[model samples]
Target: MRYNRNEAFRFAFKEPLHARFSIYEVNGKEVETTEGEIQLMDLSPSGAKTYTELNIPYTANNSVKITIHFQLNESTYNFKGKIVWKKVWSDGFMYGVSFLVNEDMQQEIVKQLKIHVKSLKN
Candidate 1:
């Protein structure tokens, strides 16, 4: 499947899921981490977009590795991602995180997204 760099095709859920994220590394240096809660807005094989009440004021195009933790089906899942974009709002920030996944992990994410889409249909 071909995707446009400018336009992203995301599966937006009606009820946003709660997730926690930690910025473990920045510019290859370990820093004091501030854990924050984010509302998972949408999902795709490539990445996800989330909204957080925490004000993470990072410059655009700044790269940082983060781990997002969320629960599904009584099991917790952690995914590694890189921050690609950050938009500041009056209350918080919206982040576009691109998943750093291998071929296998990509397939797994796609599978889970498909399941979520299917469940939403019913």
Candidate 2:
């Protein structure tokens, strides 16, 4: 089934930002955690594409119950998502993460992204 395409707008930051992520099960079981410096390549309300270097390989459609922690404006934010697509490179992997979030969380993400973008403009 084809998912609706969401326009992905890229954001540029003056300094680098890293997203620390942990992949686990929906039942709250721990799987693995890794810290990777990530570039927010593009974003939409429902999903985001990130560029990072991962030591492990993740398959497409792999239900990635992940907790992504990152700092924005000196405040830390945590988001959860599932891996919809994965591309393996010689060094690491790139993932297209579809957020497993409710309406409120979705709104929060959008708001935070907007804020982050605005901060970069200043």
Candidate 3:
């Protein structure tokens, strides 16, 4: 299947899953590593939509990347990506992280996601 640069197919879990993330990059400068908990709303091989109570400011034109770590079926996974979309709220925020991964890594993620889905159905 052909991939689209502006959009990606995402998968949603039957139950809520939480993950930890830390600021990895900002305009190529080292950061203090602001870390927080994020609820996984939906996931794709290349990106994810997440919600968190911690406030993360989105900057236009500046490169910002985060390292997010989560587990599925007892295996740990991580990715570094920038926020491509955001929705601010009074108490929390929703952000989309766009990860740049190789095709092999992408396949691994898809394998893990498939296992997660099967477990939920059982």
Best by lDDT: 3
- Give a tens-digit lDDT track for model 1, residues 1-122: 33446534466768888899998778767766877888887777678888998866466655587889986434577888888888876588888888887778767766676676676679
**Top candidate when judged by TM-score against the true structure:** 3
What value does the lDDT take at residue 111 in candidate 3?
84
Instruction: Write down the TM-score of every candidate.
Output: 0.82, 0.69, 0.85
Report the lDDT tens digits of candidate 2 across residue range 1-122: 12344433444344446677777653345676655566555555676667677643455434456667776666676777877787765476667777777888667666777887776679
Per-residue error for 100 in candidate 2, Å, reads: 1.1
In candidate 2, residue 14 scores what lDDT?
A: 45
- Model 3 stretches astray by more than 4 angstroms: 1-8
List candidate 2 stretches off by more than 4 Å: 1-16, 26-39, 55-57
Give one digit per residue, the lDDT tens place, for model 3 in 62-105. Answer: 77788899987888888888998788855898888888788888
When 2 and 3 are scored with lDDT, the better candidate is 3
Provide the global lDDT of candidate 3 against the true structure.
0.79
Which pairs of residues clash in candidate 1, taking residues 3 or more apart in a chain or in different chains?
Answer: none
TM-score order, best first, reads 3, 1, 2
lDDT of 1 at 69: 92
Which ten contiguous residues of candidate 1 have the minimum total lDDT?
1-10
